[model samples]
Target: MRESDLIYILAMAGVTYLVRMLPLVLLKKEIKNRFLRSFLYYVPYACLAAMTVPAVFFATTYVLGAAVGFFVALFLSYREKSLLVVALAACAAVFVAERLIQWIA
Candidate 1:
């Protein structure tokens, strides 16, 4: 909120940027390691799975209906279905599943 605080924040950001950028610039040609390359290849999938798994189970009924919804959408899309069709199917699955469960209980 103050002038010195703003200056300090700017300097910190500059240093952080340099720290992150310098490593890539310095290591770009040096990292010919196969293990690191393989690690990088799988990191994105690993991150996606990590985030999805926890998020899928974080809410009511473990977001169970939504998980089924996402799977149905993903599967149908994989089969060359239109995105809109897959999305509607998934939303329909969630709505129907939720209503059915509510009705049964």
Candidate 2:
């Protein structure tokens, strides 16, 4: 609402845009290194896991429920199940585990 807040937000937006855009604009040529290219390719997945893994543990009230869901998802993924199936299976596992825990407690 204030002029100073608007200026600060614009400054932050400009900095973020430049940080993301500069790499693409400056590196006009394709990356050629096998190791570096591979690493770059996996950065998004690594970031995603880093962000998601922590939240998954706290998704349920019971840690055991979350752990069961995580293991079910991992097992399904390891078996090469489709993403939808893996997600559904993990949710189901967590739901069942949580219900069991609630009933016991």
Candidate 3:
């Protein structure tokens, strides 16, 4: 790899490490503030969804299929379905939607 690429990678690693480490180092005591604790509890889920939702829309060949899959997954999850069930149902929805769209087009 190029020197510039190596430098960029090292910088990224250092930043990521610092971001993770600083929180642990700074928050030595258990956070007792109810609001802060609640907010922190949901932070990981919010971050995951923020990162994942956009990719879901672009991952499929057609946006329509992805939308169908996303809604199916959302519905199943809202109903408290098992992760495997939700995943399979979403995949099936996407597959069927894509096929229908392809056939129609």
Candidate 4:
């Protein structure tokens, strides 16, 4: 790669390393605040959803199919379905919705 690209990658790596290392270096003791602890516990899930939810809508051939899939996945997950079941059901929902849309068009 070009020198500029290498510099950008190293800069990104340094920033990422600092972000993780600073937290560990600064928070040496176990966090004891109940509210803060609870919030921290959910941070990873919140971050994951924040990253994943938007991509779900745009990753499919059609927004309508993706929406149908998202709802099905949401419903299944809300009902505490297994991960595999939720994923498969969502995929099936998307497939059916896309096919229906295609057929009707």
Flag regions of model 2 displaced more than 4 Å. Answer: 1-29
Q: Candidate 4: where is the Cα deviation over 4 Å?
A: 42-55
Clashes of 1: 0
Q: What local lDDT does model 3 show for residue 51?
A: 85
Error of 1 at 6 (Å): 11
Clashing pairs in 2: none
Regions of candidate 3 where Cα sits further than 4 Å from its true position: 42-55
Model 1 misplaced stretches (Cα beyond 4 Å): 1-30, 59-63, 77-88
| Cα lDDT of model 1 by residue, 36-72, tens digit | 9899889999998788665754543537677777788
Each candidate: how many clashes?
A: 0, 0, 0, 0
lDDT of the structure predicted as candidate 3: 0.96
What is candidate 2's TM-score against the reference? 0.66
The models' CA-based lDDT, in order, is 0.79, 0.95, 0.96, 0.96
lDDT of 2 by residue, 1-105 (tens): 999999999999999999999999999999999998999999999998998888889988888999999999999999999999999999999999999999999
**Superposed Cα deviation of residue 83, candidate 3 (Å):** 2.0
Q: Cα miss at 17, model 4 (Å)?
A: 3.2
Could you tell me every candidate's TM-score relative to the true structure? 0.50, 0.66, 0.74, 0.70
**How much is 41 displaced in model 2, in angstroms?**
3.0
Q: Is candidate 1 or candidate 3 better by TM-score?
A: 3
